[model samples]
Target: MSARTSAPSWRPANSSGRSLWLAIAGLSPPAIGDSHTGLRLMGDVLSLARRRPFTSAVILLIVAVYVVEIAQSRPAFWLEGKGDLPDIAALGVVWTPAIGDGEWWRLITASSLHAGLLHIALNCYALVVIGGAAEARFRWWRTAVIFLVAAVGGNIAAAAIQPGAASLGASGGVMGLAGAVVVGAVWSGEGLARSQWVIGAIIATVAFGFINPGISNAAHIGGLIAGGAVSLPLGLTARLRRTQRPAPAPKTQARGTAPGRATATGMNPRQVEFQRRIDAAMAKARAEREEDARRASSGE
Candidate 1:
């Protein structure tokens, strides 16, 4: 019998096309065919973390909290769908009644919580993309301010609009970052081509929220508005600073001119006219004094 040949056991199951696409997108390190691909990817992440320390810190904190969440609940809770409400509440998910009862910190804390592994995974990915861009462009402090403000604003809106519903996740803050990017681009006069993809993504996300039940559209809208509002003044200030011109250096005084007077060379029409009037008046006074002196001499 002829010897049979088989495919290598170490090869990945995914099609070459899919693997190639994933590799191109930088989404699958294993597909790159290099044993050190993971190490290279890790190094790249470390480099990005160094450049975006605040974004990295926020992402790390969210991940750490998620780890605690996993420990407190069944494996299925994270892997499949929604977790136990009581467990989630204990872990700081936002509930309107709790906030009403003076557990207001939940508004801020709930943003750091997530509904499931998928939820947190999507959020963290968005955070890495949006937060990193924001930090790179707007500085870490401004990015932090935008994230925190949007989180609180989103929770407040949810509490007001859907009092009976419980909410969790960082979608609001992510949407807020999207809004800030859009508004920031407009104010800074950046090319629309650069931001059109962001705009399309925002529209698609909001549309998806509307289609999907249990999604917090109110919080999303609130966060978008709050983020845009915050970014407006910042963008305006930055644009103003960029466009501002220093006042022309004060014209140097002519060598023979008085300290307060400017040279005619650089003077405007109005200034030149004023200087001419002053000179004419001084000449008239001198002529009058000379005439008086001549008359007095004749009288003597």
Candidate 2:
């Protein structure tokens, strides 16, 4: 009887091949593809972390603090604006009365705390944009100093202007970064068009604050002023130093001489010409003296 012939099976022939097939079918353990995807995501995060270490750390800290705030209070506190006042105060909101009682640390700490999800979200976004720019321009340490100084300045202004109200968020610091960028651009002679755009953005931001209720215009103003003040001398000194840099000495070449080439006599062209003139003068003087000596001998 003739043997019955069957078509070749599409199944993999080896265990490894079978495992790969099963993984593709979603029936096997976590596949290489999944691991690769995870690795790629981790690499991206690491790249971002390395690009701006201080900025990344600050953002992480803010988010972590917000998470702690959420854990300490009910969800309503972060989701809605109706959180308990005592709970908020405990979380380090800037209360003027508390400052009078010597909670002075709040001047800087309050900048890290937020009132709600929206508050933190807005502030964090601002930090990422403005703070990143400031960090790039002034470097991490200067950026840190600017942020802290602005935060303190803003809180102080708030305490002085609205002593009864409680305030929180990083708006002051963000505004300070914006201010520093503006001043830096101007000092670096970045041109009128760029400077105008930066100035316009600041004006628009301040205007928005004015139109919005419960926003601290005083803090914004104070931060802007403080940032500009801090950056002003730095900018001036940088400009002054740049201007004072000695001009490069002029390149000098020997007269009538081709660059990098010496005369046939192994002297520079200028030296050769000077020697020729000296020899000619000496020969003429010697000839005149000999003629005078001959004339004297004949007269004798």
Candidate 3:
């Protein structure tokens, strides 16, 4: 479920190229793409579903939650949309279980819940795209951890800095994925270049101005940090990932026999091969993350 991944890793930021503003501002938010509109988000998912039945299920998850929220609004199932957008951070904090006042499960629930239909679709699309690329070189477990931390940190940060308002979206985690992938691209010499990275980061930072306030910059920044911090111990040296040959794609098997679906959505064999590859990659990255966490926990 988590598209957050590893095979996509990072290289250290240029410290000497420091910009105090970068520190103060964080990597800017990606253009909430021109295509990104609330209604568009809702429509795009539905449109994609026509060609791919599986994507229907993805939409179902979002609809199911919205249904729950509406039902809760009816004064029955639960108060608020499982949790309010305004209260997401508070819920994650004071209401989160065991730790503060919040339910322990919110850490997980928050990922599933999103700001709105717009939020849900955007993140889902991101998962399919970036995740497709990442899993090719990483591991699932790593994806899960990255998703969890990025989503949780993003929500927490948003709540802390922009408290008293409900907000939900996989964007925080997706943004983390964005940061991780951008770093990965730079390190691996893949999709983008280092100069492009800096430029993209700058544009994103500047676009923050037009983000129309109330968006969670905190969560965005926090997720970026989490991606970077977590990447450090994954053996992601400057040249290691850059010079490496790409990992092979995961091979598929009989329809039901494939360990994982070749294509969760309506996809060609090539697409399936691509997904299998990325999933395999994500799984590998997760293994590394586990080892890294283990090492840190053991003070190794």
Top TM-score prediction, candidate number: 1
After best superposition, candidate 2 residue 90: deviation in angstroms?
A: 1.4
| lDDT against true structure, model 1 | 0.68
**Is candidate 1 or 3 superior in lDDT?**
1
Which lDDT tens digits does candidate 2 get at residues 1-300?
Answer: 101112121110000011112222233223566758787757755875787676777778889988888888667767754455665567776677888999998888777777667677666656655777778777787788888888789878877876656767777777777799888987787754654544665676677666654567677788888887787776676567769999987456445445533434467656767866776788899999999999999995
Sort by TM-score, top down from the best: 1, 2, 3
Worst 10 residues of 3 by lDDT: 9-18
List model 3 lDDT by residue over 255-287, tens digit each: 522454543455667776777678778889999
Pairs of colliding residues, candidate 2: none
The lDDT of each candidate is: 0.68, 0.67, 0.48
TM-score of each: 0.69, 0.64, 0.47
**Per-residue error (Å), model 3, residue 129:** 2.5
- Model 2: runs farther than 4 Å from truth? 1-46, 195-197, 236-300
**For candidate 1, which ten residues in a row score worst on lDDT?**
9-18
- Is 1 or 2 the stronger prediction by TM-score? 1
Total colliding residue pairs, candidate 1: 0
Estimate the TM-score for candidate 1.
0.69
